[model samples]
Target: MLAVESRFTGASGLDAMGAAVADALVPQRLQTPDPHRFTASVTSVDLGSVQLVRASAPPMRSVRPVGSPARPDGAAFLLLGRGARGEIAGGGVSAPVDPDHLVLIPGDAAFEVTYPERVEVVFVALDAPGALRLGLAVSGPLRGLALPAAGRALLAPALDAVQAAAAAATPADVADLAEVVEGALGVAVRAAAEPVADPRAAVRAAALRLVDRHLRDPDLGPGWLAACLHLSPSTLHRAFRAGEETVAAMVRRRRVEAVARDLTGPAPGPGVSELAARYGFAGGSHLATAFRARYALSPAEYRARHGSAHHLRRS
Candidate 1:
């Protein structure tokens, strides 16, 4: 579930607003030419595995100096731009934040962003492992440079969902929703990187990497891949046609194989239902049917025959 932890409807003074910002976001130095004239509203939410901070304010400068405490483990800040134009400098590089683009600022080091006009920005703090599980890590802090329009379009709905859910008292299955956003963020980051050569083999290779990384994502399929790679659906299909299996088949087969490995691993960990959800199965029954088809054994039977717990008992 997701819940709103704190909210500042309107804080007249910069100090008051700063206090709210620090409590929700990381501690930082906030300044403006006329502190008295400043007006702002901020809201912070705890989404179980993620944190979201939204701030609306007039022109200002915010800084997190060197030697500041590193962000909590697995945390990466995604600044989604909205009506804000500014410059962000971090790790000895600076980039502009315009309305058309998004910025990823990993909090493991120092960073700063200055906006010269009225600005509204949504900052999402997500787990690094969550993103890596979906096959993405931002190479470094990125801003200023324009991301592909198609990539930006793909990310819009995920961010919109988060903002819309902020008003609800408690949204169901929020962790899953958070992971979806993380996957979308990764796809956007990859899309923003240097373009790959447009060859059938290259497209197939790149698509394979994406498929392997996002096997656990329910949304990992042809439509999503086409958007991520900035190719038409027909073109994407043609690229994979000569392969052993279609993209859809690959996703299903890979997910089932991943679940089977988990079931038989030396560590007796997540149960059937948990594994099902983790690997993108609709439910335990769905996973059971798929597992039986692949290995000729129900998940429980497979575990009893080959799992770590079974081995331990035998020993």
Candidate 2:
């Protein structure tokens, strides 16, 4: 869990903050552009797959580009507070981050994030798979723009949940919550991207992607997803009919598949309730109910039979 590793109100504190920022993010250059003394506080959590950092700092300019180790390995999402403001430019594209928008920074790609004023933001870093699944790695229409109103509405709660979970969650719990957070972000980002040419197809793609991201949330459904994607319940239904599986089936399948993947993966364990909670199941019983419905074995039994103790990591 992310704890307060350092806090300072003056130059000394800022210097320490700079070192902390570098350690948490990467080697980078920082500058105070306004000649102001400001207090900065940063709390961070690393969940193997992602690092979540919350920082409250004065105005500063940050430049991070392709450096040693060849551009690092992931992307970052900056969820700006209501009063936050900044500009991030890189790869020939520059985007402004006023109170209205969040920003995405690709680690491998050179970029500069400048906070023109004091800002409080939740910055999330995800590995390549997470970045691609969230669709933040591509230069889609929504790639670098401000999150739309609808997107922002959904994002706030997810960010809050993640922020809370980061500080108090166990490593296992953090991983699960990270998945949930990733799903929420994917939907939020997808919503802001340019809509596809075919309204029906676009909505379907977006709706399914949202469902895929939140498949584990017990509340995930047509109504909730419809609102997230700015579609009506009926529209959502129609979209699903045109697809291969109904929305409910897709959600169930995805959750079951995810659980199965985790169960069979190298770590080989999380109690039933713990595992269930990760995927939006109401509890162990709920997961067992679903697990039994979809597969012959119960979650526990299934894990016992197929679980392995091997974990693969990036080199």
- Give residue 17's lDDT in candidate 1 (0 to 100): 71
lDDT by residue (tens digit), candidate 1, 1-315: 354444333334677777776766677888876776677777676665567777788888998888787565334576776776888899878877765566666656578889999888877776544433334343355444356886678776776677567567356656666776677766776677733223555566556667777877778888998776667889878877877778777677878888777777776556778888898888888888988988899877787787876532221
Superposition error at 283 for model 1 (Å):
49
At residue 310, give the lDDT of candidate 1: 58
What candidate 2 gets wrong by more than 4 Å, as runs, is 2-5, 33-36, 65-71, 74-82, 138-143, 194-315
**TM-score of every candidate:** 0.55, 0.55
Could you give candidate 2's per-residue lDDT for residues 108-165 as a string of tens digits? 4566778877887776777544554554443231235567888788877777777776
**Predictions: Cα RMSD each:** 12.1, 14.0
Worst 10 residues of 1 by lDDT: 130-139
User: lDDT values of the candidates?
Assistant: 0.69, 0.66
lDDT of 1 at 262: 79
